[model samples]
Target: MRLLVTGANGQLGHAIDAALEAKDAPAAYVDCVVDWVDLPDLDISSASAVDAWFVAHEPYDVVVNCAAFTNVDGCEADFAAAFSANALGPMNLARACATGDAALVHVSTDYVFPGTEPGERLETDVPAPISAYGRSKLAGEGLALAANHRTHVVRTAWLYGEGKNFVRTMLRIGEGRDEVTVVDDQLGNPTSAADLAHEILRIALTDDYGVWHCTNEGICSWADLAEAAYEIAGVNCRVRRCSSADWKRMNPQSADRPAFSALKNGHLESTIGNQMRPWREALEDYLR
Candidate 1:
């Protein structure tokens, strides 16, 4: 199979590469020819560029889109860039794949939902994005699904691996600090990129084409995640839990986040049997 992975240098993209390289990679990936591209290599946001690339390298069996404008605050400041990357990028890929047999696996975030409702969000839940970033992603999701029938929209939350992320920030702060303040109101699953990559591969192998919530099994607040990271890494740091309002007060320019955006892997559970571990277990494995 010929596979295309965009945003090849990002955390989730790197994790997918690692998974394919691992000894335990699925048999389907054993004979797969993978193409990794990012920024200079290929701008997925450009429809002409995407079409040209697809024409140059025809017959891609799978296209995993990990590219996204993930800066939440930056999205609020510049919605155009966010829409171009997050929404238009996926649409371009979907349109390209529409002419072929490639199944598009678009990675999205739980932020698509308004966190005001306190519960684990199901794939069937109606999305009401609050911030520009969320709105862009939601648009991407819709466009991808509409453009291609073989599209899998996988929504995840609080992912961290092989890049600048919350866990890394906590670890860096803990190296010298005795305490760190974290928001306790915002709740979501802290997913490991490795785990998410594994699941994405599994989902790609099947014909289950629709929205799928693929997050770690458990949920927690930002403060809880920070504490867990410090504990797992054996760092001597105390977590000073604060409300979301407190965090917003300190960082006024920050985009508004969902209060409870935990996603339930209902589709995965029903279709392929959810293999995701608990959030803490995944975090421990990642830290190790």
Candidate 2:
């Protein structure tokens, strides 16, 4: 199979490459041809560029898009740029894939849901995004699904691996600090990018085309995640749990986040059997 991975330098992209190279990687990838591209190599937001690239690299069996405008606060600052990258980018890829007869697997986030409802969200649940980043992602999901029948929109949460992320930030901050403050009101799963990448590959192999939630099992607040990371990494740091409002008070320009945006892998569980491990277990593995 000929595979194309966009945003090739990001955390999930790196993890996908690692997954394909792992000793126990799936047999399906043994004979796969993969192409990694990002930024200057390809601007997915441009429709003409995407079409030309598809024509040049014809017969792509599958295209996995990890590219996204992930800066939440920045999205609020520049919604147009965010929409262009997060929404228009997927639309362009989906259009090209529709014409080329290639399967499109687009990575999304749990922020698409309004966190006011306190429960694990299912794929069937309606998405009412409250923030700019969330709105852009939600739009991307709809656009991709509408533009291509063979599209899989996988939603994940609190991801970390092979790049700058919350866990890495905590580790860096805790190195010289006795205590660090984190938001306790916000709740979601802390997913390992490696685990998510493995599942993405599994999802791409099947014909299950629709919305899917794939995150490490279990949920926790940001403070809880920081404390867990400290404990696992043997860091001497105390977690001062505070509400989201407190966080906003400190960082006035920060974007609003969901209070409870944990996602349930309902589709994955029913279809291919959810393989994502618990958040703490995944975090331990990631840290180690």
Candidate 3:
């Protein structure tokens, strides 16, 4: 199988690379020729550039699109860049895949839903995005599924691993500060990029295609996650909990986020018998 992975330098992309490199998981990626591409080499937002690359490469069995414009506040300010990367980019790849009869695994986010309810969201749940970033991603999801027959949308939340994410930020801040303030009202899973990557690969291995929610099992507030990180790191720091409103009020530039965006991994577990580890367990392993 010939596999093409975009956003090769991102957290999830790096985790996929690590998974492919593991000798113990030879069967996972065996007989697969993978090509990793990003920015300078391939601009997914440009249809012409994307088409040219597809033509040059000829055929690909699978295209895992991890590339996205993830800046929520930035998206509010610059809708063009956000729509180009998050929405149009996936459409280009999906169209290309449709032409080549290839499967598409598009990475999405739980932000697509307006998080007002307290329960975990299912794949069947209606999406009512509130922010520009969420709308862009929702648009991408629709286009991807509609453009390609073999498209799969994987929605995840609260991701961190070996990159600029919450866990790393907390660890870094703990080094210099005696206390950290985090939002206690906003709730979601703290998924490790590695775990999400592994799950993506497993999905790629199958021909079944649809929307799937993949994240570390348990859910918690940002404050809980920060406290867990400090505890695991053995950092002597106090984590002060504040409401999401307070957090945003304190940081005027902070983007609007879902208050309860926890996703239920129903389809993935039902279809593949694969469920992610709990958030705390994944965090412990990641910190170690």
In TM-score terms, candidate 3 sits at: 0.97
TM-score of each: 0.98, 0.99, 0.97
Q: For model 3, what is the C-alpha lDDT against the true structure?
A: 0.91
Residue 82, model 3: lDDT of 94
Off by over 4 Å in 1: none
Q: Total clashes, candidate 1?
A: 0
- Give the range of the ten consecutive residues with the poorest summed lDDT in model 2: 22-31
The sequence of per-residue lDDT tens digits that candidate 2 reaches over residues 78-185 is 999999999999999999999989999999999999999978999999999989999999999999999999999999999999998999999999999999999998
List model 1 lDDT by residue over 1-288, tens digit each.
999999999999999999998887788999899999999889999999999999999589999999999999999999999999999999999999999868999999999999999789999999999999999999999999999999999999999999999999999998899989999999999999999999999999999899999999988999999999999999999999999899899999999999999999999899889999999999999999
Sort by lDDT, best first: what order? Answer: 2, 1, 3
Q: At residue 168, give the lDDT of candidate 2.
A: 100
Q: What TM-score would you give candidate 2 relative to the actual structure?
A: 0.99
Note the clash tally of each candidate: 0, 0, 0
lDDT of 3 by residue, 109-143 (tens): 99999999989999999999988999999999999
